[model samples]
Target chain A: MKVITIVLQIGFLYVFYITGSLLQRLFHLPIPGSIIGLFLLFIVLLLKVFPATWIETGSAFLLDYLSLLFVPATTGVMNYFDLFAGHTIWLFIITMISTLIVMIFSGHTSRLLARYREKRREGTECQQSLSESSL
Target chain B: MSTVLIGIVFISLTVFIYLFMTRLYHRFYIPFLIPALTSTVAVVFLLIIMEVSYDTYMIGGQWIDALLGPAIVALAYPLYNQRHLLLKNLYPILGGVVVGSLTGIFSGLLLAQSLGFNEKLLFSLLPKSVTTPVAMQIADGVGGLPALSVLFVMTAGFTGVVVGPYILYWFRLDSPLAKGMAFGSASHAIGTAKAIEYGDYTTSVSSVAMTLSAIACSVFGSLVVLVFYA
Candidate 1:
């Protein structure tokens, strides 16, 4: 019974994926079918058409095994070995440099904005309390 | 052998090795060691030693590959769980991810282009900041190699795992929201894994950032391709 429920829940996810696949084909969207399916599932959840419990087991199962699913792609890296032979140094340099720059800039930018918002919220709260005290 | 039999045995071998390495990493608690890196290294070496062709390995590998789509679709569950937090911090999350993704895309592109890298390589590197599944999809959409893009994504994730925490520390950025967003947007899953070490709140926030970044990078990547490349 438990296994059957998990299977049915997974089936629910696939239904969304099929819808996404069909939408992608019909519309020629650049988005992947899976992503469109993700959006559809999100909207379905948001609307309370189905509660989280309905899919939690299957979702948890898939996510727990997420890294395992990616093993194939990592091995696919071997296919590009010849391509990297002449450009190994360049690939390494570009990947490291770009990654560093992105991490630093994004980290700084997000922290800066979050702080700014936080300070502004405090200010608004202080003003509200001041007004309330005066009243 | 039969191809089907080879595929079965090969997959079992890969999973066994991967699980073993994961346990080893957890037990040792090595600061820089990541299971994906170690497992990939181990599997590649084992395959080479065994003379198992990439074709044969993929015969089993493809079973894992097929799950990528549903896994991505399942991502929506996390996003849905965080809907309230997302609504509350909408502006900051949106602002941060947009800037972070643009930084990721442009920095990689300009650097590679300046180095005179070819178009295929440039496109592969373009989606390095997004999660692997979406990154691969974007790479294919933009006429790049999907496999290569996954490599770049992994590299970026590793980079984040190695350097991400130190950068946040040096800057004294203690906000959980900021830390999570930075890690998720810039490094994808690897960064999120690091964020998980921070605490539960950070993990939830990073999940939000990772999901949003994937969506942003995809939409933004296609637009760049449509407008600039085409």
Candidate 2:
């Protein structure tokens, strides 16, 4: 019974994916269909069009094994050995350096922005309390 | 082997290897021993040793690959769950992901070009920071090799899981929001997994970051391609 529910829920999600693909083709969208499906589902959830429980179990199951699903595609690298042969070290360097740059830049940027927000909130709270006491 | 049997065998083999790798990862808890990386290497080498052509392997592999689209849609659940937190911290999260996505694209293109890589390789490197499925799509759209883009995405993911924490600590980015945004924007799903160590709030923030970064890159990435390749 539980297995059937999960299967049905997954089927429901697949419907969204198909619809997204159709929309992409009809409209000539540059974005991937799966992404459009994701956005549609997100909008549906946000609008309370359906209860979250309907797809909860199935989405959880799929997300848990998400990395596993990537295996076949990742393994496709086997077919592209020639392109990667001379560039292995350079590829690693570029990915590593870029990864570091992104991590640092985003991390610090958010942290500073968050701190700025926090300080502003505190300042407003302090002003409110002072005004209330004066009143 | 018959086509039906080959499909079943390959699917089972991939699943079994993934399960075994997961167990090994949990036992050792090493960053580099991630199941995705290990199982992929294992399966690839197995195919090479058995002299099995990729086409033959895909007889089953394609079945598994077909699920990737649906799985991507499943990402919406987490995004939904994190909506409250995402809305509350909209500025920081949005600001961080946008900047990060641009940095990923520009830095990757500049470095790769300076190193004298060809146009195809540059396009492949452009979407390396986004999650694999979307990155593959963007790469295909931009005249890059989708398969090679996966390699770059995996490398970025691995690099983040391994080195991201140290960078965060060195920079004293103690806020959960900062930590989550860093991992998700830089590394996608793999980085989100690492963010789990910081607790649930960080995990939620990281997942949101991952999704937003994907959306940002997909939109901005094409514009970057138009500027360069067009």
Assess each model's interface with DockQ, reporting 2 decimals per model: 0.59, 0.68
Please list all clashing residue pairs in model 1, or write none if there are none.
none
DockQ of the two-chain complex in candidate 2: 0.68
lDDT of each: 0.77, 0.85
Model 1, span A1-135: residue lDDT tens: 878887787777878888988998899775668778888998999899979898888877776666666677777666666756676457656877777777666666766776788899999999999999999
Instruction: Kindly give the stretch of ten consecutive residues in candidate 2 chain B with the minimal lDDT sum.
Output: B192-201
* Residues A29-135 of candidate 2: C-alpha lDDT, one tens digit per residue: 75678878888998999999999998899888877787788789778878877865676569668988999899888888888777889899999999999999999
- What lDDT tens digits, residue by residue, belong to model 2 across residues B4-100? 9999999999999999999998999876787878988999999999999889999999988887778778878877887887788889888899999
What docking grade does candidate 1 earn? Answer: medium
- Grade the docking of candidate 2: medium
Give the CA lDDT, 0 to 100, for residue B107 in model 1. Answer: 81
Give candidate 2 regions above 4 Å deviation. Answer: B118-120, B140-147, B169-174, B189-203, B222-230
Question: Model 2 chain A — which ten-residue stretch has the worst lDDT?
Answer: A83-92
Would you list the clashing residue pairs of candidate 2? none
